[model samples]
Structures are given as structure tokens and as C-alpha cells.
Target: RATKSLSLTATSPINIALVKYWGKVHEQLIIPANSSLSITIDQADLCSKTKVELIPTAEGAEPQLRLVLNGKEDKITSRIRSIIELMRERTQGVRAHDDQGHTLTLDASELRTHSLIITSENNFATASGLASSSSGLSCLAFVLSQLYGVSESFPDEYTKFARLGSGSACRSLYGGFVQWHRGFQAIQELTEDSAKVSDQSLARAVELSQESMEWWYNNLSILICVVNPGDAQTYQKDVPSTDGMKITLETSELMKLRLEADLAQKHIDQLTGYLEERDFPKFAELTMKESNQLHAVCLDTYPPIFYMNETSRQIIKTATKLNGQGNIVAYSIDAGFHVFLFTLKENQVKVHEAMSVLPGIDQIIITRIGREGVKLI
Candidate 1:
């Protein structure tokens, strides 16, 4: 059979989780203890573009998967090679036909024969403590899955692939209000069995994140405050979010106490209740508390990685103060200290004008909830 060509592409946005994925129960699989929620931003000039292509091979040569990164030929290391191996393992018996009558069998060894090209570019900037890595990696993984014929039912497989590349990539699989269900790898293991259950809870949970009916869609806007992009020389430094979680497990006695007393759930529910009431003060309080908890765990680490600096703190304080009274404005910080300020559309110009004057601030990009994830042309 003659081998044929194939290509796929996906553009993914950087998402900020409301109920964040702080710790993981299963590090290897990237499972989280609690669920997380996020909104996909459309503008503010941040995104990742990924393209995947397949080519036919000759009869005798060893299969090769060439990875060209940023227009340069790159070697596949052990870490990335694992994903190809897993893809081969999962798609062993499955057969895919190209435009020509050729059948492609995914063999671990033969992956090298065809070139798997990946090129990603961030719209605004890279390593400025922005979530570009997450969006880029997630977009690559998503594009590859589509090219390789993987289904969403195999989220663990795809998300695990993404997680190996970037910690937050897994959550990008869904759009609105996603949750990783931390430390729970069995969600994928039992998916086949659970699919038979009558309640269909998994379907419902997936629905919740993918739904477009969330309250903040039209009303909420986010302002991005950029700093020096955080030590550009330290680009793509591996933080290992799971490792951070392990450190939290050992040092954050509060985390253990919350787990034992089920306080995290109670606290999360309280925040949700407040959101239901449209109470900005309470929501802001919970968001600030959660950010503090996340950073506290970061501090609990041996070397103590500090994600939030003086500039980060100033933005937080100013944004919180500006959204005063019964107003519906809020601020939430992610793994990086970048502040994602949620406010009304009417407040956009004023917030931008105000942030422009702040010291150590670079630029502000305004964005709102993006439409559901889609394929690129």
C-alpha cells in the first residue's frame, strides 16, 4: 500500500482556573485531588498555534518522528519519546487509511520514519510569567490527537500526553469551567466501565465544563498585567507542578488538615454559593485565599519558589481596591503571579488607563470568554 499524507492543526487559548488545580494525587498520570474550573480567553493577544503532519515511509529504514521546533530540527528525547510510544501502544490494532489506499499502523519503532512537525508561537510574549507554555503544549497535544484519531473518551491518554509536556496542559482539553479532579487517575481507567452506569455522571461533568451558559461570558472581562516576562533566560524551566504538590503534601500541614477535615470542599462550596448570590466581596475573598494557599504551598517547597513578587502584589492590591463596594469585579492569580482581573465591560477602559501608570507594568491586554474550542484551518 502506498503511504499518504495527513495534517491537523489546533489553536488553543491560555485559560485561568477559578477552582484551580493546585495538587495532584497521581503525579505520573497528572490526576488532581479536587476538580478545577477555567474560562478560555479570546483576545488580549495571547494564543498558541500547533500543526501536525504525517508522511509515508520507505520499506527498510527505521521509522523516525522528526520534531522541528520553532523552524529548527530537534531531536526527540526520552520524555517526549514516551508519548510516541504510548500513542503506538494505544493505536496498535487500530488502522487508519490516508488519501491513498495505504494503511498506517502506529508502531513505536516506526514513529521515527515519518516526520511529526510541531511549531508553536505565542502572540504577546513568552516566559513573562504568562501561561503560554500551557496553551502551546495543550494545542500541540490536541492537534496531534486529532491527527492520530484519538477520541475525547481517551482524555487520560491525551491529557497525560499533554501533562508530560506541561502541567496545566491537561485542563485545556475542556473549555469553560474545567476541573482536573486532581490525583484521580482512575477516572480514565474506569471510563469504559462507568460509561455503562445509569447515572451518566461523567457525561454530566464533562457537560458542565463544555457548556456556554456560564454567568461570566457577557458580563466579565479580564485584564492582563505583564511584567518583565520573568527571567527570560529561564525559559521553559520545569517547575513540575506535581512535585510542587508533593512538597505541599509533606510540608503544608494545613493541606493535610483540609483533606482530613474535608475543609477544602467546604471552602470551595462556600465560594460557589457566593458566586450564585453574585457576591463579589465573598468571591474575591475566596479567590485571594486560594491564591494565597497555592503560593503558600510554593513557599513550603525546600528551595521555596516565589511566583508572586512585589509587582505582582501591587497589581493585586490596586485591582482589588478599584473594584470596591457591591461591584462585581474580582482578581485571581495563577501558577505564575500574573493577575487575571475579572470585571465588567464598562470598567475596561478605566482599568486599562489606571494600570498603564503602575510601575514595573509593561502592557495590559483585554479579553473575554472565548467560544468553545475549535479546529484551525
Candidate 2:
């Protein structure tokens, strides 16, 4: 049966992982090898705005998906197709009822047949090795969920559903300080009398950030230096992260040692504590160290992957100088050459001074963390 037309709009902010998610346990499911934490930057700075509509199609009409990113037609269609199919499968067993308990559709088959029109635009450059995919997919998932009334029926499926589009996209769905907890860690701590809940069925409050200290996240400033400024459309890694991880897991003995030491767990513990206590020194130290080790793991890969260049190393040096001058800035470089400098609001002047004088920096973007999460517009 044909359905009435419906549309929804949404915006989701980009997130930068502090404890990076470098490997995957299940690529199909997008399950990470370790839990990762991130800060939701200001929505006004970098975000993706999306509009999803469900229009009644002709009896034999096929689903139509139109994607325009940053005002240009791109090739992200296949990813969106996978997401829709996955969501449809999840909705298979679901039965939607009206106010009077009347079934809305004949069955799941009828619902899956419904077509959707998706239009998305990003505030920043997409496919440029930036976090555009994370934000765009997040916004898409949120809008799609609303169109399907998934938000009202099954609240827990939102992030998990968004994850199908992109792994880091799940973290973008939440605001403030968010962590995609690796479910396996739950096994080490639960009591005997506790329910037989797997990592997926754990119990915890949704908002991990404490309200009394929400202001802490708001005041933190992040300065992004796009050293590589690669095209997001083809913003691929010099060494594909997935391929690099496979080689690292199989060949790098350091990775095995790090796993044995529970390196990510240790980093998370210290970083979380430093964040809570507002210890800039400890926070900065661990951030830099983890960033270094992450790259070291990449280098440890069989072929020795390299994402950063000469200018990236220079940026790190400049950040250290800022720290020495009492500015207290911490820098983290991801798989790309982009550098994320974390500092407090008070040290923004020093940050400006240091970044402005630095040569070869294409752009220095100043923004904050712990911003409001995704929402309908």
C-alpha cells in the first residue's frame, strides 16, 4: 500500500576521538576492537544537515536516493543503501500500531518497500579526510529514524543503527563526553548474581557527562590544523586504516603487547580521570603519548604506513612550545595529517599566537567541545 508523504530534518556535530578507535573486531557490524572516547565539538563550527523524506511511490516504483553533499553530487550512495537495508532488517519483527491499536502496514515486507529521498549538505568540506562522513551519516541516521518513528518505539537502536553507516558516526549521535564502550570489557567486572547481560545488554545511564560539570566541556577549546587538507571525496589514507590494522594485528608484535597490557583501557582510565579533575598537564601528556603510540602502531604495520609529514611534526613542536610558555596545549594527530590541539578557553590567546606564526598550516580552526548533540530542526 502507498503511504502519505513525510519529511524530517536534522543536524549532527562532528566528534574527535581522544582514545582512538583504530581496529575493528567485526567489520560488518562495525564493532570496535577497543572502546573510544570523543568530544562533541560545537555544532555551528562543523556539522552535517540532512533532510529525509518518505513519499508515496507508484505501485512498482523503486526506492529513490538522491545525495548532494556540500552542494555537489557525490558517490556515497552505496553506503546509504547498506544502512537502509540493515535498518529495514531490524524493523522486520517490529509492528507499528496506530492510536487505536490498528496495524499501520500489512507487514514488515510492506514497510521495507517504502522508498526514501535523502538530501544532505555539510558545513565543512566533505570527503577531505575530515570527519564529514561521521557527521553526515549521523545526521542521515537520525533523520531516517524519525521518519520511521524508531525514536518513539525503540530508543536504544539509534546509535547502533547509525553505526551501520559509519563506525565513528555512532559517537556523533551523542553530545558532551561520549564513549562507545567496547562491550567485551563488561565481562571482567560483573557480579555473579547480575543478569546474564552481554556487552550489548549492559546497564548504565545514557548521559555519561555529569550536569554539575557540564560547563567544563563547554569551555574547552579545540584548534584544528589541516596539514594535509585532502579531498574528502577521495580523502583516503596513504595506508587504508582497515588494511593497516589487518597488517598490524597479524604482524606487529607491539600491538599484541599493547593488547596484553590493556593499553587502551589504561589510557581511557587516566584520560577520563584527567578530564574529570581538569588536570591539563596530565591530560595533555596522555593525549600526546597516545597519539604517538597510535602512529607507532601504524608504522609497526608490515609496510609501514605514514599519514603525517614534515609539517605535521612541526605542528607538534609548536604545540610543545605553547605548553612550555604556560599555554598548556595538547595535540593529537589522527590517521590523517590533521592535528587537533586541545586547550582551555583561557589559553586561547596563546593558541592564536602560536598557530598564526606557524608556517605551512593551511587553516587553524578554533572551536569547542561538549556541544549540544544532534536534533530535529
Candidate 3:
């Protein structure tokens, strides 16, 4: 038999959620408690590049899988294993033409006869709450789909696969403005089938008018402020997001209000309108408010998850002070110390300067909003 080896590479940009996804309704399916919205960062500035290869294994040998992240050998987490198993199940009998124009067919049985190797690297910090998993897992899903010739059975089908690896990862599968729908209510009211629920939990790009797109590209800029340039792994949260969410749901009264109000969906709707109208002040206000609410919910959680440090608080104060004079800047922080500031290109320098002078800020990266999502190199 001819040596059948296949490989593919893909890159995905990090997506910073404006309307955050803090909790989960379904853990195994990675369903969110609330819908979320985000802007994809440009891949050139921050992204994860993932490459996968399948090589035939000896007839009597059990196929093995290996993963290397950022030049370090890493154990295949259960989440990643689930994504691979899903890809294998979905890609059975799928066929496509490779880059060399050779027709390739994927066989479920034969897939088990091959060893898989995945190498992924991120240009930015990981585990420090910069949404590195968003780019990392999305890139993994994209490369796997491309390699196996997996076709989307529904709209954003691949996004469902990405969501299996990380909830926010689904948003990274698209570019420009994207939204991850919270299908928990729909799933509960409908059916309990896992596959159906996964299908309903989807992320899709928000349609922006050509003018809005142009304005966003031309006028908007993001400043990523790194609070500490130390090893990102050291900055990993004491409380994992999943655990934090579970505690919040059980203990935080504010969390109850947040869910009852459907705050995330509301913010997404309002932000979408503000973006369309090119109303920076309204957009900025909503963005900052949502960020505050997310942290507040964290504080309300029993044992209170504290993802922000004093330096993180200082950045928020500085941004707020600057915004008092003019709403030229808005700050959003995820479950990490890094602060993402959104401002117009005209005020980029001013915003960067203010952030740079703040103590404990080690680095500030300037990049524009990304217009594309995961793509083959």
C-alpha cells in the first residue's frame, strides 16, 4: 500500500467578548448560560497556528496521538480528546481533494489505523485569560476539519465542534463581529438529544452594513495591556472557569439577576445597534458596563473568584478617568489580568500612552479588529 500521509495547517485569531460568556448551562456540551458577542483580533498580532498530520501505523500497532503546544509536549486533555473523537465520528466516508488534487476519502475504521500528531503555537500569552483557548482550540478544529474533509452538516457546524473544546472557541471560528447563541432554553424546551443540543448551540457572524464594516476597520483599534510579562502559565486563575460558574450559579444572587435580566443578550443587541450607528460613546459605555458586571458576578460568587489584581483595578480606573473627559476609550477584561482597550485609531496613541504609564503594565500590543477567522495558511 502506498504510504498515506496527510497534513494541514490553520490559524485562528483570538476573540475578545464584549458580552461575555461566564457560565455554562450544560458542561459536557459546553453550552453557555447566556449568549455572547465578541470581536476577533487580527491574526498577525495574536493567534494560534495549529498543524496536524496523519501517518499510517503498522498493522499490529495501536495508533497513538501526540500534541505539542508552544514547543512543549503537553498531555492531551479530555476536552481535546472529545473533539478528536467527534471529528472521527463525523468525518466517516467524507471525501475531498487534497492540495495536490488527489481525491482522499476518510474511513472511520482506517482512521484508527493512523497515528495523529498535532502541533500548535500561540503568538500571545496563554492561560492568563487572554482568550488564548479561543484561538488555540478553534485552530485545532479548523485543521482537523480540513484534514478529514469534514463538511458542515448545518450552519456553523464546525463551530459546534470547536465549542466542545472551549465555549468561546466557537466565536473564534468566525471573523469580524460574532455571536454565540445560548441555546440552553431552546434545548431544554425542545429535546434532550446531545447532538441536537450541540447543533442548536452555535456561533455566527453578525451582518454589518458595508458602511459599518468600513468604519470599524478604518476607525477602531485595540490595545492589549499585559499587566505582568511573567510566564502566562503562572498567571492561571486559582479558580477554573467551570468551577467558578458552578459556584456562581449556586451562590451568587447577582448571578440570578443577571440571568433573569438576560443581560448578555441585551448588551449584545444594544452594542450591535451602537456599532451600526457609529456611536462610540454608547458603545464604549456598554462595553465598560458589561465588563464591570462580569467581575461583579464573580465577586458575588461564594468564596468570590478574584481574577483581577490591584494592577488590573488601576487600569480600569485610569480608563474610566480618561473616559470622563471623552469616551475615546473602553476597557474590557476577561477572567485574567490582561486588559483589552478599544479606542479609535485617532486616539490610539493617547490610550496607549495612558496605559503604558500605569504601574505593573509590562507590555501593550496595538492591533486592529480582525475581519477574518480561522483559515488555512
lDDT, each prediction: 0.61, 0.72, 0.84
List residue ranges in candidate 2 displaced over 4 A: 1-3, 76-78, 92-113, 152-155, 186-212, 228-235, 325-327
Residues 199-218, candidate 2: write the lDDT tens digits: 26211113434742465665
RMSD of each: 5.1, 4.9, 2.3
Worst 10 residues of 1 by lDDT: 196-205
Q: Which stretches of candidate 1 lie over 4 Å from their true place?
A: 1-3, 58-62, 72-79, 92-112, 152-161, 183-215, 229-240, 274-278, 323-328, 374-376
lDDT for 217 in candidate 1 is 63
Model 2: ten consecutive residues of lowest lDDT: 196-205
Residues 224-330 of candidate 1 have per-residue lDDT tens digits of: 77654445434243465556677776677666655565445556567656655656567667776777767776776666766775677887777766766654456
lDDT value for candidate 3? 0.84
> Alpha-carbon error at 225 in model 2, in Å?
1.1
Ranking by lDDT: 3, 2, 1
For model 3, how does the per-residue alpha-carbon lDDT over 1-377 read when each residue is reduced to its tens digit? 22566788999999999998988777888878889999999999999999998877886788889999989999999999998888788775545555577876767777767899999999876755578888999889878976776745533778877888888899987778999988766323433345566667789898889999789989999999888734444777778777888899889999888888788888999999999999998999999999999999999998899888878899999988888877999999988878999999989998888888888887888998998899899
